[model samples]
Target chain A: MAEDHKMTYADPWMLPETKGFWEALNDGKLVIRTCNDCGRGHHFPRAMCPHCYSSNLEWKESDGTGTIYSFTAQQVKGGGKYVYAYVEIADRVRAITNIVDCDPDALQIGQKVKAAFRPSASGQNILVFTPA
Target chain B: MTAHDARLVGAYELPYRHAPDKSLAQMQAEAALGAVADAGLSLKDVDGFFCGGDTPGMGPMSLIEYLNITPRYVDSTETGGNSYVSHVARAARAIDAGLCDVALITLAGKPRTPAKGSRPMTDSNKPDQDFELTYHPTVPANYALAAQRHMYEYGTTSEQLAWIKVAASHHAQHNPHALLKDVVTVEDVVNSPMVASPLHRFDCCVITDGGGALILAKSEIAKRLNRPSVKILGTGEAVKHQGAGDIDLTWTAGKWAAEKAWKMSGCTPDQIQYASIYDSFTITVLLEIEDLGFCKPGHGGGFVAEGNLISGKGKLPFNTDGGGLCSNHPGNRGGMTKVIEAVRQLRGEAHPAVQVPDCALALAHGTGGSLGTRHGASTLILARED
Candidate 1:
């Protein structure tokens, strides 16, 4: 059979460079931004430190652990339910992410969670926090 | 410039004329220039600048490069629609602190982007890396989810949300420049196509290219100006959460901002004769009505649906200029439009048809982003004479 002409090529610019965040996920570790100047760590990693405005920063692999700060269960029509979380990692850093591998209603604040990477569409992976 | 004794000495707003073809930058410059002229000042007097991140040239550094104005204090805070109102207070404080004598706060429409049909999703920054984008949960879907929650918790019907759009459209009928000038009924809103669950096409705000600006100066300078000074009695900003995961989507950080603004302005909810709550979605206004203490929690659906939000007989009139729901809302410019309406009502210059009767105390509020995530609210309290 001839190749279907229905397939369209994805744009080159569409690829997101998330290897840094995903690489740590593959290693069963969570990575966050740690500032050398102020000794603070943050989720949603950035090249420059937000607290001290220091460009000098390093990546610290988390203990694959954290506690839930807060969360919300979202239900979209035609889409299943899922709970998003505010997780507090080491060094007083908090991030808004998702807690997976658990029932949405069973989620609790201060629940211990560990990092896990799961395969996603397009040969990529995502970081999901599960109860430790 | 003095201490942090910031006050809104003057404000200006132009009608929301639809100009989808104009570039965002041109609209921004026009608005800024008009505001300066209205204040009887010149751009040369502007020493500080603030604007929304969505503008053509945004960020403190980027806008300065684009506008070619060397502002001592420059900020491009992007908290969505409320950014303008919050920037107003921030610029006012900057002016009072002597950081700048005249501050220019302006925002234009969202510049069109080619790749995504709209601006890339926030999570697009980490697309291959971010999981949320994979679900295709754009803002409309996010708002749809929140609207569902509101319906679940408060028995808030889709019809209730439609009432806000109906009331806003009613006001827009008198506003010649309003994009949706025709009056609509609750039935019309319900029958409209559902863009997302619980939100119809009519429930959403219109997108048009426009700009607005306000020139804030010290009291000494404002006192001598020819135009009536719309003294900024108080300004406050609050963020409920940086993202949708933190707060109860039904409640908002707007409550906190209003708490501070009302306390500082020395006014109570009962004193406010008119209000301008951002109407990105009809549900947003419903949430603000309750959050701002205008009505009890879980009563927003009733407050708006039962004709309380309409002008004249209503205890608190809202969006006399049609609002984002029925007016031309070019992204973050909605907030500035709200403030301008309040100032005009205070000055008794609102178009005769939509003018609030004897408007003495006014409240303007704005919120951006979907429910439960990164909510931004700015509340401003203004009095005719302070």
Candidate 2:
């Protein structure tokens, strides 16, 4: 079903601050930046910690497991149905990802999910989630 | 002496239709000129400007240059539909501080009639592109996520959401300029094509090519104008989140922004005779009404389900111009139109069928960006002078 659509997903435009997160994704690892000063974690990487304005940040591998906070079964204008959702990867941190490998209509809140990496139409690895 | 004393003396809505021949600049110029004329002021009296749009080469400077006005103040706060409401508050503050005397806030766009060589409407630099775009979430899908969550948490039924559309369409029937005036029902909305789960096409706002303008002046200047004026009694603005996460889906920045506006206005929710709450989506109106203290949290769906928002029904009249749901939404600046409608209602100038009798105070509120993620909320309270 995923291959039916001829859509091409391009690699994200990397900024100087976000290079590390994309590089880690390429290495088959999910990483989140943790603030050294405030002991907080964030995603879609930023240069400085959103909490406490700390520039002292460190990268750490995540378990890549989260719970579905909310989701929508989206039927695009010409595209097929897909489940888009906000999955909480850590305390107070959520990542937007697609829920693949399951009936989109069957998705429920608080459902446990795990990361699954797949090659984009352009051959760049992208992260998706599936029922754990 | 308070900054909240600014007055809106002039309001204009450009002919709401698809005029491909009219450039955005031309539409903006017409609306600006019309508003100034409505206030019985010459163009030279304008010393401040505010605008927001996504069309190429659209900004405060471009408008300033096009109008050829040397203004003492300018603002281009782009927070989607809520931008213009924020401008109203900022304009009031500027006038109160003696930074400017007459402020012209305008919005124009041609989303429905794109030119032959126009650029793609979607821009790639949006913050959500980093993550949320990868999942193929359309505007309707983003709101559907909130509707879904609201249903899960508070048992908000799809039928309840549909009632909002029905009420909007009912109001549109009286508005000659509304794009969709035919009456709609819960069945009509439920049977409409599903854009995203829990949100049908009818649940979303109509896209059109139109513009609106508002002229806010110092109370003294407004009093001298030959036209009716609405006072900016109170205003509040807030932004909770910007991207796909971090904020609660069921709640919006309106909770905080409306709280401040209510405090500053010294007016309770029941005192608001007319409301022009932004309706970028049906769920948006429900969430805002709840956050603004019009009804209890988790009870918005039921409150609206009782037909309380329908014009001439004796309840709080909302979106009396038919709202974005049925009237028009040119890009993300529906907030400007909301202000225009509220002003019209307070002045006893609205379509007679939809006008609330003896309307003394009005509220105009808007939400920008996705409800599921980070977004901006703005609320403005306006009153008619005795």
Which candidate wins on lDDT?
Answer: 2
In model 1, the runs with Cα more than 4 Å from the true position are A1-119, A123-132, B1-10, B14-21, B65-67, B110-129, B242-246
Kindly give the stretch of ten consecutive residues in candidate 2 chain A with the minimal lDDT sum. Answer: A1-10
TM-score: model 2 vs. ground truth: 0.94
Which candidate has the top score in TM-score?
2
The residue pairs found clashing in candidate 1 are B8-B232, B242-B374, B243-B373, B243-B374, B244-B372, B244-B373
lDDT by residue (tens digit), candidate 1, B92-144: 77876788888888877643321125555454455222434433344555565
* lDDT by residue (tens digit), candidate 2, B213-240: 8899998998898898888888899998
Question: Can you give the lDDT of residue B186 in candidate 2?
Answer: 94
Displacement of the residue B83 alpha carbon in candidate 2, Å: 1.1
* lDDT of each residue in A3-108, candidate 2, tens digit only: 1233345566556787787777778877888889988888767888887788999887889898998887777557677777888888878888888877776788
Candidates in order, TM-scores: namely 0.75, 0.94
Give the TM-score between model 1's chain B and the true chain B: 0.91
Local error of candidate 1 at B343, Å?
1.0
Please list the residue runs of candidate 2 whose C-alpha ends up more than 4 Å from where it truly belongs after superposition: A1-7, B1-3, B54-58, B116-128, B242-245
